[model samples]
Every structure is written in structure tokens, then in C-alpha cells.
Target: MQKISPCLWFRNEAEEAVDFYVSIFPNAKKGEVLRSGESGPGPAGSVVLVNFELFGQSFQALNGNSDETFNNSVSLSVDCKDQAEVDHYWEKLIDGRGKGLACSWLKDRYGVAWQIVPELLPRLLIDPDKAKAARVMAAMMKMVKIDVATIEEAARG
Candidate 1:
């Protein structure tokens, strides 16, 4: 059991969201699901809470309405090992309905923000050569889904 897990609130789509998320990650799995009981806040037998794991990270989804909603302020960052990994995740997460944003940020179909970043991104951004780092940043700024090759070429400049 994990000491702390992020609980996401959905408008009665917790189960669906969990399923979608698990399908995207190879290491993800569906865990326990708790349905609302009769006379509860939600309809009986409807999903109340769902437990799941994505890449070994435990998370819970709640099928309840709240004053708050998901925003770009919070996002799940996926550190990809290579360009292929970055492409895979970016495509999967932005699956038609989701919106791709600048600098490798995107929102999934469920409105959850995600950052599919390559492992080399940070190193390039923090390169000892300020000119190279600036070039990399400039290249990154123009891209929605980051291209590792472009970043590398920019860094080499």
C-alpha cells in the first residue's frame, strides 16, 4: 500500500477514466472499485471510487461532483526514455479528443493534463553552453509534441 495516492474527481466517469488510463500504460492495472450504495450521494451501483495503478503509481478516481475541476495547473508528467516513448505517449494521450499544447503538454480525453517529456529534455535545457540551451528552448517553444531530433539539433547549434 502506498502512503499517499492522488485522488481524481470526475463527474461520474471514474470507472471509465480508470479503464482508459490503465489501457494506455503497460504497467497499469485496475484495482478495487467501490460503488455507491442505495440512499447515497450517487445512484446505487454507480461507481463511487476506483483504485488503479499507472506505471506502479497508485491513484484513485472519485465519481463525484465538486466545485473544483482539472486544470493545467496540475499535470501528470511521463518521463520518456527516448523519442519513440515520447511519441507513443503523446499520441495515446492526445487521442483525437484531447488537445495538444505547447512544450509537450497535452490534455487527455478526460481533461487531465499530461506532459510527455523526453529524458534528454532536461539535460539539453540545462546545458553548460547557454547558447545551446537557448536554442533548444526556442525549438521546444514552437512544438506541441516535442521532437527529440529537433531538440538535439538545436542543442548542437
Candidate 2:
């Protein structure tokens, strides 16, 4: 068993969310679906929770009858290899459901925020010269995820 797991609370779309999430991540898998029982907190036979994994991280999505409270404070960060990978995820994830901002922040239909960032960001931001890194950080602060090329340019300047 994994030492840590992220438990997500959905209004009533635990199964659907799990399916969508599994489809997006490369090594994702839908493990099990637990239904409410006679002694369960939910109505008997109704889907209560879904167990799944995304990029090797295990998660549990609960079908709780409550309002969703997902915000920008907590977002899934997708470390992409290049612009193509970032674009693909941005297009598919944003689709007609979520709002897309410059640099790579997007909110899905479920109101979950995601940062489609390039894998090169850290290397560029942690430059030997503090001034250069600071400039890059300034540029990144205006962005959500971050563009690899833009950060590189900022670091060079």
C-alpha cells in the first residue's frame, strides 16, 4: 500500500471523474468502485467511492452529496517534456469546459485547477546567479504553469 494517498471529494461524479482522469494520464488505471451498502453512509447500492491511480499516484474519489470546493490553491501539476505535450494536455483538458490562462493554468469542468508546466522550468529557475533567477521568477510569477522558452529567455536576460 502507498504511504500517502490523495482523497478527492466529488459532488456525485466519482466514477466519471475517475474514468476521465485515467484516460488523461499515461500510466493511469481504474482499480475498484465501492458502492454504498446497508451500513454505509450513502444509499445502498449507489456508488460511494472510486479507487484509481494517475501517473502512479493512488487516489480515492468520493461521491459525496455536497458542493464542490476545488480552488486554485490546490492544482495538479503535469510536468510536460515539451511544448507539444503541454499543448496536447492543455487542449484536451481545457476543451470547452475549463478556462485557460496564459502560461498554462487551466480549470477543468469539475473546477479543478491544473498547471501544465514544462519539465525544464526548475533548471532554468535555479540559476547560479541570483539576479537571473530572480528575473525568471518574476516572469514566472505572472504565469500559471510556465513556458520553457520564455523562462529561458528571462534567465538569459
Candidate 3:
């Protein structure tokens, strides 16, 4: 169990969100489900919260009847090894459900934003060469998911 886990509040799609998330990440699973009270805020037998894990990170999906509030302010960043990994996740997660933004950011079907970043990007950019970093940044700015090969090529150029 992680020390700190993010709890996502959904209108009424906690299970659906957990299922979709688990399908995207390799090490993801639905943990536990919290049922609603007999006569509380939610009806009995309804799911109030669901514990889920994605890539070793714990997360809880709350199915509370409230306003849907999800933005790009706080996004889950996935460290990918190469372009193939990045592309795989991008295609699976996006799935024509959410909008894709440049610079390795995209919103899932539930409006949750995620940033698919390459593992090699930081090392290549932080090589104590500001010019090379700037070039790589420029190339990365035009991409939805940071491609390691493209960033490496840009840094060399």
C-alpha cells in the first residue's frame, strides 16, 4: 500500500473508471468496494467508493452524487521506456473518449488527465546544454506523448 493515494470523485462511474484504468496499466487492479449506507447519502447496495491500484499507485474512486470536477491541473504522469510504450498507452487510454493535448497530456474517458512521458527525455534535456534542451523542448511541445526517439533526435540537432 502506498503512503499517499489519490482519491478520485466521480459522479457515478467509479467501477467503470476503475475497469478502464486497470485495462490501461499493466499492474492495475480493483481492490475493495465500499458500499453505501442503508439510509445515508446514497442508496443501499450502491457503490460509494472503490479502491484501485494502477502501476503500484493506490487510488480510490468515489461514486458520490456531486458536480463533476476534473481538470488538467493535477495529472498522472507515466514514465515510459520508449516510443512504442508511449504509443501503446496513448492509443489505449485515449480510445476516442477524451481530448488529447500537445506536450504529452491527455484526458481519459472520465475526464482524468494523464501525461505520458518518456524515460530518456529528462537525461537528454538536462545534459548541461541549454541549447540542446531547448531544441528538445521545442520538438516535445508539438507531441501529445513525448517520443524518446524524436526528443533524442531533436537534442542532437
Candidate 4:
């Protein structure tokens, strides 16, 4: 168990979101479901809270069932080893509904913001030579899905 976990407020679909999240990631699972009682905030047997793990990180989601929405102020940044890992997450999470934003940022179907960053990106962006780093940054700024090879080329040139 992690010392701190993010609690997501969902629009009455925490279980479905948890299932979708766990299904896409390796070493992920649905931990437990907390249901509403007969006294009822929601209908009896409705999911009120969900505990789940994604790639070993614990998270709790609440079935808020409100107008509150997920926004860009907070995000899940996925550190991928390579482009393939980045692509895998993008495809699985989006599944055609998510909007791809600049610089590897994406707003998924559930309105959750994600950064599909490749490990190579940081190394290139923080090179000892500021000019090269700037060039790499410029290249990255133009891309939605990061291309490691392109970043590397920008770093060299």
C-alpha cells in the first residue's frame, strides 16, 4: 500500500472507470468496492467507492454523481521506457474518444488528463548544451504523441 493515494471523484461510474484502468495496465487490479446501503444516498447495492491499483499505485474513486469534472490542473504522468509504451497507453486509454493535446498531453474518454512521456524526453530536454535542449523542446512542443527518434535527432542536430 502507498502512503498517499489519489482519490478521484467520478460521476457515478467509479467501478467502470476502475475496471477500464486496471484492464489496460500491467500489474493492475480492482481492490475493493464499497456499496451504498438501504438508507440510501444512491440506490441500494450501488457502488459508492472503488479502491484500485494501476501499475502498482493505489487510488480510490468516489461515485460523486455530480457535475464536477476532471480537468487539466491535475494529471497522471506515465513515464514510458520507449515510444511503444507511450503508444500502448495512448491507444488503450483513448480508444478513439480522447483528445490528443500538445506535448504528449491527452484528455482521455473519462476526461482524465494524461501525459504519455518517454524516458528519452527528459534526457534530451536537459542536455548540458542549452541550444540543443531548446531545439529538442521546440520539436517536442509540436507533437501530440512523442516520437523518441525525432527527439533524439533534434538533440543531435
Top model number, TM-score: 4
TM-score of each: 0.95, 0.87, 0.94, 0.96
Residues 67-156, candidate 1: write the lDDT tens digits: 567899989999999999998999888888899988999999888999999999999899899999999999999999999999989988
lDDT string for model 4 (53-113, tens) is: 8877899989998999999999999999998998899898887988898899998888989
**Which model is ahead, 3 or 4, in terms of lDDT?**
4
lDDT, model 2, position 150: 79
TM-score for model 2? 0.87
Model 2 ranges off by over 4 Å? 38-40, 101-103
Residue-by-residue lDDT tens digits, candidate 3, 1-157: 4688899999999988998888878878899998878886688888889999887778999987889688988998888888899888888889988878879899988898888888888787687889998998889878876778778889889
lDDT for each of the candidates?
0.90, 0.82, 0.86, 0.91
Pairs of colliding residues, candidate 1: none
Show pairs that collide, candidate 3: 104-144
- Candidate 2 weakest ten by summed lDDT: 143-152
Candidate 3 residue runs with Cα over 4 Å from true position: none
